[model samples]
Target chain A: MHSIDFIVLFGTLLAIALYGTWKTRKSHDLKGYLLGDNSMKWGTIGLSVMATQASAITFLSTPGQAYQDGMGFVQFYFGMPIAMIILSAVVVPLYFKLKVYTAYEFLEQRFDLKSRALAAFLFLVSRGLAAGITIYAPAIILTAILNWDINITILIIGVLVIIYTVSGGTKAVAETQKQQMVVIMAGMFVAFVVLLVKLPDHIGFKESLVVAGKMGKMNVIDWKFDPTNRYNIWSGLTAALFLFLAYFGTDQSQVQRYLSGKSIKEIRLGLLFNGVFKIPMQFSILLIGVLVFIFYQFTMPPIFFNKTETDKLATSKYEQQYNELSKQHQQVFDQKRVLLGELVAADKAGDEESTTQLTERVNKLQEQQESIKAEAVGLMQDINPDLDSKDSDYVFITFVMKYLPHGIIGLLMAVIFSAAMSSTSSELNALGSTTVIDFYKRMVNDSATDAHYLFMSRLFTVFWGILALLFAVFATQLDNLIQAVNILGSVFYGPILGIFIVAFGVKYVKANAVFVATVISEGIIVWLYFLSRAGKLGITYLWFNPIGALLVVAIAVVLQAVWPKKTT
Target chain B: MLKNDSFMDFLKTPEYTEAPVLGNWKAFYLTSIIFFVVELLLFSYLTIAY
Candidate 1:
């Protein structure tokens, strides 16, 4: 990156952080620290909620996902709007009525201390691990593209978030996130426009989209019923419904975002706004990736997008073999380009038969190219078993670094860092609040002053920030950081949402029964997940949320009927 | 007349309150659901037309 990029990146990030800290400097009580004095409007709350969930991975990995897989991933969010409506209609008013600082606080009031503690514990484990991933996702890509040390990248992001979050708490996170969301969206829109502008003169936007559609990148909706298919409409509506319910309704990081709103109306508006806008936002990001895929058709892309690993292979004993594979890939590309020109001509001339024939031929050539690419990846894996050979995550950043202007490159980098910081800050804030409110204040010092609680809140924020940084360092061992975060959430969110479901709907099921049910259900979910991983089961992870939740409710009801009630 | 009054009472349940923009909670919910339907249709159209 040039000096211009550095200036823009650091200047934008530091200004947001400093502004948040300054704005919330006097928030010295527990309420202000944890819930932003319960004064945020819908607009701020909505943007904050979006920013918290977007994360660095959403910006970095999602485009790569589209570049590789296609637009079917957008279906995964079909359930989000439904989830938001349910939360607004059912969950928001309940929380407001309870005047709760955390979602778990309502659980304790409805169920018992053990139930609340269990739900909070699940959230802590899942979101804590996910916070590390939010930092690690950007760090790994930046390290690969910029040649920066991964550890330093992790440290820079972790420490920068902790400063404002520890200083000003929830208000700080929410306030800064408003600005971060602006930067993130602006950068993405700029990238999209630049990709269009950078396309070959022969290919206009509509023609490029036609090319992409012909190549199967525009398959946005799949209606076929398959339980194991991850992104089909059924799974998106069913399993994803339960997952989003758990995430937006029970996850402390998100719950805390809206809880800081001025009233139930404000919170509902904020959530509904998210529900309305989130799908289109994700579609846009994925569309940019598809556009990039089309752009690469006219211009040759790298054999492997991850240059660091490819460079390593080049200097090793496999250099000759790699060069041979590269030569073959170029031949395929040349053939495909010639076919593409004819296909574009055929398409423009409204010649349907030739278009179909050319499309099939081009697809065959593309498959041939993929096989050679796979062989090269296999060879690289043989040389270094530990290297991450999956290059989809590197596609967008590689394009950015090589193509975008200097100032905009820095702005895009800032977009990534802003996303990372926005998410990590919220996670730290929620972790600190849950630790202080659900465990420390409730159990350790029930009679502590507001001053004491506020101090503990800041201290816990710092503590969790440090813990997340450590986890980020360890996260390099994982494959595909975005999937890692989601899978972690899916594993734990089921039982936690089940606990809340019981508390909300199954009024007859007492605390002891639900608590026992939650423990057993979580154990079963973990075992089932392992079975699926080991190829012993055919279930997908998305199913885990609904299955885990329903198991708790059903088991809790049975246990409530059979087991003896115990006085607390 | 009695049934109509009871139906209105159900609509005026204490948990229900004024929405920020829409007239009431039910209206707000209806609007959100409508938005959801519109989005689904738009996506389906994109899938078919492309």
Candidate 2:
């Protein structure tokens, strides 16, 4: 909020946007505009792919997830490396050989016009709405924690992304993302080091880890196979594999990232780069949360991370009750702080029996603290019945705003804004290209000049950008923006991936069978998702990916056998 | 089905080039898988040891 911080944030963002627009200002041809003239190397393509996926929510809410649920969420990405390798080996070369502008174009050559349109329509519907959340998620949290106006925050992010992406097209998106990734990683690493330094002199890094682990914050892997459990090895390896495959292999936003590569070799290497480094990047972010948890053990964190809710509670009729709870919460924290010190000492001195005893006592006190906080949250809900009760999304930003230095605060804000722009730019760029290439050129105006198509691509980019901004302004009732986006993706990605899988693997299944099967499979998946949401079904969201895809494949096979298409 | 249209023929087209640093695409993929396995092992250790 300081002038210096504002300067740093805006200066960094404007510099990158201007640089990208100026660098690619000469783009005129449709191919050059849509595909970056195929000039990107593996490094730019790799970082662009990473940036498209790591939205503002990844940096803003992931640490909060770690703070609340521990590191088990890392399991969500366990399938990423395998998915990347599969894409590199099988999908990349075929795409290059086909020389398609959009991933759905290959579907038309393999199947028929209707199939391509169906897949492209599915992508536009799912990704269009998701682009809204990409901007809104960080804007909501940043504005709440920083006390900025929400509409201005949203416009700042959406308009800047639209400016660069509409100006330079894919080349601008890719070029700006390179600088954004540098800022994102540097800001996170600096925050990590600061979190370490902020710890008490007596509690070294090892002691901090010991405190966090015994307190159950270091849970990185869950080998259990429970289907309903969201984060486990089984779900990550099997179900998330389908999700990742659909996301990277079939989605236009990601497909366009690698499609801009100079050659098949460049694209494959780009994907492989993401494959090798994605997990480690995620691991470091989660570790920062664990460090924050340990830091809070020595210092008192807010009774509730979201001060906006608590601020309302201050004037409510239950103010006395909340005050009593806050007092009780402070006492519990004070008690646990002493016990955590003893627990760490016992572990350091190799006294296992004393360590176990101290751990139980400290955990009990921690539970008391949580119960008081939960009561406060209940009061907040009573006051405002429609308020989202999950405060985990506010945890990391609260820490950054309160504890981080001023200049660093600006840099971290830039980090969030950079992430927002990097991802939204890619989404708009892809949405525009898909509209022009897959629908407009193919259907509405097949004989247009190259200049006209290029102009339309830029026009559609702005069109989608405005639509995403309008959606962000209205996206206020969603619960846990990250999960909402992923759930939306899982609902549609399966059938799209299914159509592609059949196109590549099953030569016997014709266009009619696959198309009809996909329609039915999507209907089934959406129904199943609602059933699970209502607790009638016990399946997790990740299961939707494999379930929908397999349903399409199976139904297509059955339909093909029952009513075979006549060869003309 | 036509021979050129088969997925196997696409695989046999020899369009892929050598991977950067690793020289062979197979070697690069193998190394990537190996790196993934090591990460899993490291995470498991973090789960147990800490």
Top of the candidates by lDDT? 2
lDDT per residue as tens, model 2, A322-380: 88988898899999988887887889899999999999999899888888888888999
Candidate 2: TM-score, chain B only: 0.53
Model 2 RMSD in Å is 2.6
TM-score of chain A in every predicted structure:
0.97, 0.98
lDDT of 1: 0.87
Candidate 2 C-alpha error for residue A399, in Å: 0.5
* Model 2 residue A367 distance off true place after TM-score fit, in angstroms: 1.0
After superposition, the stretches of candidate 1 with alpha carbons farther than 4 Å from their true spots are: A474-488, A564-568, B1-23
What is the Cα root-mean-square deviation between model 1 and the actual structure? 4.4
Tens digits of per-residue lDDT for model 1, A322-385: 9999999999999999999899899999999999999999999989988998998998899888
